[model samples]
Target: MTTSKRPQNRADWQALAETLIPSLETRAFIDDAFVDAASGETLETLNPASGETLAHVASCDAADAELAVAAARAAHARGDWARLAPAKRKRVLLRLAELMEAHKDELALLDTLDMGKPVSSSLGDMAGAIGSIRHQAESIDKVYGEVAPTGDDSLGLVLREPLGVVASIVPWNFPLMMTAWKIAPALAAGNCVILKPSEKSPLSALRLAGLAKEAGLPRGVFQVLPGYGHTAGKALALSMEVDCLSFTGSTQVGKQLMQYAGQSNLKRVYLECGGKSPNIVFADCKNLDKVAKRAAAAIFHNQGEVCIAGSRLLVENSIREAFVDKVVEAAKAMQPGNPLDPESFMGAMVDETQYRRVLDYIAKGREEGAQLRAGGASLEGPGYFIPPTVFDGVTPAMTIGREEIFGPVLSVFGFDSEEEAVAMANDSDYGLAAGLWSQDIDRIMRVSRRLHSGQVFVNNWAGGDQTVPFGGVKQSGNGRDKSHHSLAEYTELKTVWMSLQG
Candidate 1:
């Protein structure tokens, strides 16, 4: 397959470059400045496109995490940031968003190199990240408390206050976007944040801290600590100084964070975790080819590293074979290539560990009697690359169908009745998100209401607007991330009831 072509000159660069940067800095952002980790340890950032070392990032440890947490705690206690009026806080957030837009190219490049997502997608992510900040900034003052009607001579009211010192652990798949999802709301709500980006893709988070500084955000209000999960992530979760813990990652780690929250200070824990989401396709009224292509893109996008990926495909028996054929054809058309290329649809996996885990799942699927339809093996290269894989004749009990493969692997299963399809989809422990494809309005309404998932997509897959709440049910984890409701997660409500005087 041919790789996507690159831009020739400055004019062509406009299509790809979201921001213009003077230069890319290789450093960590902490305590209001760009600095290296205290330990002086460093890890090499690799370009998955070419399996080359892009740069070296600070290898932070527990000490670094502690420093960041301390900084956040100090900021909160001093009230240098939290004492600001909502409008002033909004101004700071708006400035941060502007800075993010200005630095979009650097952020996108870092994301492409660190996580191996296509540059086009990375640019989109940068834009989304900026929008998230702006959304929360515009929303800060509008979020008001309730005023209850009281008896004569008595006034009753409720007020909302910031939950101080939030430790936000963001995942690698959409590093900057997830960071903004966690940070923008917390900061807008007047809380200090200590962000922990996944070690695999920490560069952008570090760069964002620099941008935050450039935007004139107060010292210690926001700090970025890059380190392994066991050390830095654990410290954040278990820190008594932290008032709330927000995380986006796997189900296993979410459970651990909950435990830490319970043991530490019983602080509020918000998690957006794993998903084995179902994409149900019924023999509908129109456009099977379009549905097939969309299905392929839904699963194959970001190499299927998304938590809401429509991995388990349940199709009606009548059109199963034809749908599978169309999906396989679409998969064959995808070419994993250099992420720097604007046209590349697929790129390498984040790291070797994830690559091996995906390969194991593929092997397990074959051993368990699922027929490999297309693209099962790993790609030949130094970078961790896997082909877009599809498996047919898959049973609900198969490992590939049950587990979150989290790779470019799509499993196809057929069902006869509507009840059977719903049953198959809801069988998993995860209830994050599910996709239903049918032109039948009744079917869409019925299936959407019946599904035990958080966000249900009818005739589409994983398209979220800022106004809508995004989260999951059961093991997929709890607490909404993106809407006006998200502001509630970062706040504490207090009721003031007064007694009437004689």
Candidate 2:
């Protein structure tokens, strides 16, 4: 795979996309080649931006999953990857990263067409994915095993070894980025990986398979199975041959995977699941205007499909009305537009089902008596698009305030004091992420420490680099991703002690 000339602007991108859409790879990649499902069945992948069928992708099921698992098992046993030298593995992964960077434009375009996210956003996401791979590759040789403390007559060693087979099931919201987050570390640790991408956005993963092959990954070392969650996803989770299952999606599905793991081989399951994160704004915060802009982007970005989106906004009562007004204006400016257009800030929902689900939540907000402040109706068009919707005067008991809508909807609540704000933010089943804006260092530290979230941002919203660990507690699921911490999940720690008696 090599770099191709990319389009410069919206019109150019639209023209280029027309030529690329017709030739996308739509079959599963198994054992380093694209193959049809064993059942010979295919599923139609729709473009949410235009409500049109992009391609008929091979619909893999349990049988295909079995094939993938067998390949992974064989690859692990063959020792071509799992037993390879760390330096050699690092070189292969570095080459893969280079290939991904070379063909980033094509990968980004496929994600945009398949999932209805803005092309600009996909491009940025591709950069993150590529960088993650590079980071993992570079860290391969740097990870050191430990020599445990022991008496002179005894020797103790702690070793980190790769889990045999890793099945990565990623969500459509950030397909490439999330997939990279899982597979890069697993592969960097010299493990065989089988990726089951969301049926809604499988193109990027399918495209990525060929690059893996081009970068010298052994046959059967990496594969992509594209199918429904109940079929392909369940098969991977329940397979006895799989040694680890890493997933990012809804909490409900995460629980199912856990059950499957228990029923099967008790594979190591690492999940980063759903969230109804809160963004608390204190009265002592300086720069209300900056806070309002960040608040809008935190919830409204990616069309509010983000699992860590700041959907619940907690504001101090003294600035609740004024802050919401500014947020509303910012939301108004982020109207839905053609995903191919670089200028578009927001795009259509992933599909009609999610589109209607968000709409149903909006209707429930109205029925539950939350005050509607901004856009509420769905946009009249062929695509599944809903403009940013804001609901003020929301109580903690309201449906919109408590649930994860997973759309561009904001529920606002007012609190009288810092204690009340912290309480409101912690009042959720999810503890994935939270945000608070305050100038006072004492308040920022106090509130940040008390929030029941895995990651907290003060004076910003979801602003963290790849070096930071990302995960959640409670229902948001277990295990972490990113940085050296994520690498631990893909590996197992073993201690060996030897006695030296002469």
Score each candidate by Cα lDDT: 0.86, 0.93
Query: Model 1, range 369-454, lDDT digits (tens) per residue?
Result: 99999999988867888989999999988899899989999999999999999999999999999999888888888989999999
TM-score, each model? 0.94, 0.99
Model 2 segments more than 4 A misplaced = 1-4
For residues 44-161, write the lDDT of model 2, one tens digit per residue.
9999988899999999999999999999999999999989999999999999999998898888888999999999999999999998999889889999999988899999999999
Instruction: Name the TM-score of candidate 1.
Output: 0.94
Q: State the RMSD for candidate 1.
A: 3.6
